[model samples]
Target: MNVAPVTPPRPLDVAAVFPQLVPLARTATRLHPRPGAPTWYDSSIGGPLLWPADEPWPHCEGPHEVDGMNPVLSPADVRLERRIRAASHGREMTPQEQKTLERIRPPRKLPMRPAVQPYDGSMAMLPVAQLYARDVPDLRAPKGTDLLQVLWCPFDHPIMPRTALFWRSAATVTDILGTPPEPPAMQFDAYLPEPCLLHPEQITEYPDHLELSTELQEQLSQWSVPQADEEDMDPQTYYDCVLSNAPGWKVGGWAAWDSTDPCPRPCPECGTGMEVLLTIATFEEGDDEGRSWSPYENPAAEPSPGSDHFDPGRPTAVQIGRGHRQHLYICPAAPEHPHLELMT
Candidate 1:
């Protein structure tokens, strides 16, 4: 079993400092996804899914953005390049390796694969995550469903890969797909997520001030910073970054609203307010690894050998829109309702 760290106490008692904010508290499950071999049975990020063999694999019929410049590269091509890129760290790339990269840079006619169930032009979606309700504490599902599988078209749906959601009963998936189909070509390398097992940690959170009412926002802005050293800094900034949202992959939490101001994200099927189902994050924590939302680990424990030396916060190797987050929002009233997607 993979070892998961425990999140230490918050820098200050937010509730005690601001009693009125008590009602705003929401529980979020921080899915600390780390590099590991996760099977279909596991709740994981970028791991092989528990997809049924008989059912057709999901594909994004993107009305996809076609920028005539960069050639769409196959999943294998991107994976090969990532491997080379990772190996080249701390050392110069070999002449052959450099040449290989240069060759793949240009657009070339990709050979078609043997028809897998007579494929149409729609690109095969990449597996983004698979969450078993048992593993993720906050993953509520529709009736008779306990598993959630997420997939995304490897091409950009404007800014990021468009996601599709599926929820099913684990017991019903008798014949699991041994190998799933891959997109013939993907637009960006970051769209593909490296397999990582999850360590879901539940924590309480409040909404970013941007999501609060005007009166509350004004009140929060005037409140004093709880930390003595941070007194000079803006109180709203301190609360938003430190006291509010817990970073990394999480479920059922408030939106940070960092990229754009908070906006209406109502479910299309039924105009109900949507709830955060899953948050696919870029970095695990804030500026200081040991501070803010980062977990506190045993100081004497030695670093494990053979761990991927990629971005420490990015064990999954998935970078969303220049190190931001992508959230999947489901209807709280009816989870089966069409979900909402946002990048922040």
Candidate 2:
């Protein structure tokens, strides 16, 4: 019989963990702020928040669905709808007009979940959550209308949960506004504000203001600086850029296509299935690594050492924007097929 070996206790650093625990700890430490803590009132009408003068507004960088609907439901459409209604001159809507408006009414009920099968192809008796959203009129009528109502079920997957929630929410607005639906877009840094969890008495406002999480606030702060675009900036520094803005993970756009598969036909320019060649992903200063630097709008000027280069080949250095991107790499072998067909 062997005796059990003793295990050493692991060391913990309270100091290192302090920063991570502070925000939540602060919220729990105080039962509540005094009657007048800091009241943040949103009165931007229907427009975007003015954003703090010292801070930059966050731009969507992650994968997201771009709508392809004609007569698309957009912020601008909200204005057009009002104009059309105003031009009617107080005349009551005809049956056709009534139907038109009714068709645009947002969804109210939660969507049904598909039946799932266990080992025997039957769903477990677990509860499922459904999500829904709708639209409402603006108080001032024209500045903006409230994109009303969103519901989320508890059963939703946590990974990329916001994508589904946001899509369902936006879809309701799109349907009621007579907008054709677009596939969902997913981006790394983009996010919807977290909903407030409060009792009816605790919250006076019927509609709560969307609050960005402290972590998200910090991310937006980092992304806001114009200097971050500098070529000298670390390539890894912009890794968030690729995560937030590139289109491959979802669908659509040139980035969505898969170049690795063998092409059925030859390339468009060379009449051969274009081979995937390793090229340097280089950043030029002032957006002009190749062309003569323009005086009108020079965004960047020199390549920074912080930039990381990805090479399928063993090349340490290569020219960017030369034959690397379009002619040698991006073209299709077959004339019949679109070069940039997105891989699902």
Candidate 3:
């Protein structure tokens, strides 16, 4: 089912407050994905991609160690656990409930030796996300290409889930490969994304606080606020409400560099600066109301009573350090040039 576009919250007019920021706006498209199966031509997460039959499918050759155990739980077990938790909210679990809980979440066995072991060469790469230029206007594929496909190994590299990028023309793919190889095992459930269609919504964005110069920072801090009849507003609050970094998954928006200083990665093949192609985020919105970039047409609409915790940002079921975003950058000069991934 097609959902309505999310209405982006009105950001504070920083340019009007600080004239220097007028030229800093950039367009971003939020690709909202939900859980379902997708076709080759559709924009989806963890879905079959349009590819030539002759092209070799990508796979991860690991000496891969089982980074962690990801227990597969049945939906019935999940429902039962939820019921037990809901019923026992304010009271201790009854003996029967305790036994059921124990059975639901059995103790996991620890590896006999050091967990670091070589990959047995059985893991296969899985499709992560696919986007067509027709769906996302901001997708920066090569001159002749109209599609971007991302695949990653299920296990983590030293840098965590390593990904590969492919750019191609949808028109050129006359023979689509029907069956793709699947990963034998996944280290975490978060690594597996339920297929979702994209409801791409375009919006304008500004640079994060760290990107601002010291003078601009001071100006932001010292700007005089118009006094309301009752109270005065803090300039810092204005900045936070308007000028702070945009959170969650986005395309062509400013990078959320909360963990460290800005590290501009250069293209290995060419000297051109790489641009952010996509940001895989953990949550759609944080506690800050200003960062609520929901694409729903009506922002005030409430979710179903029991589904209030539904998070749009985690649609892909992918997470980085402490739920930080994984930023993928591409060379501006050449779209097919090797891409870079950074988790912040």
* Best model per lDDT: 1
lDDT of 3 by residue, 1-344 (tens): 43555745654566777777778777888776654457887998767899789898998887566643444344345446656775676799999998997887667776644445454766667787899988887787788888888888867776568888988888999988888777765655466655565667777677776678899888777663542111244445545434544566677777876667787689999878988898887766643443445555533243223321224556555667677778899888987888888887
Window of ten residues with lowest summed lDDT in model 3: 300-309
Winning model by TM-score: 1
Give the per-residue lDDT digits (tens) of candidate 2, residues 1-344.
Answer: 31211211112222133343233221000001001111112111111221223432222222223222212133223333433454454598667655654444333344533333111111111100111111111111111322211111111122221211011122223212222122122111111111111100010000000122557445544643433455344333232222111210101112112123223435555666432211112221112222111121211122112222112121112122221221112332332222322121
Off by over 4 Å in 1: 66-71, 106-120, 225-234, 287-291, 298-309
User: For residues 1-344, could you state the per-residue lDDT of candidate 1 as single tens digits?
Assistant: 43576677787877887777799899998888776678989998888999989999998786665444465567787777777776787799999889888777754455633332222478989999999999888888888999999999877667777999999999998999999999887777778887777778899999888877888777777774445235444554777777788888898888777788778888899899888998988888764323567777722133234334345567777888888899899999999888888999
- Can you tell me which runs of candidate 2 are displaced by over 4 Å? 1-102, 110-234, 237-271, 275-334, 337-340
The 10 consecutive residues of candidate 1 with the worst lDDT sum are: 298-307
Order the candidate numbers by TM-score, best to worst: 1, 3, 2
- lDDT (CA) for every model shown? 0.78, 0.22, 0.69
The deviation in Å at residue 310 for candidate 2 is: 36
- Scored against the true structure, residue 8 in model 3 reaches a CA lDDT of 57
Q: Give the TM-score of candidate 1.
A: 0.87
lDDT of 3: 0.69
- Count of backbone clashes for each model? 0, 33, 10
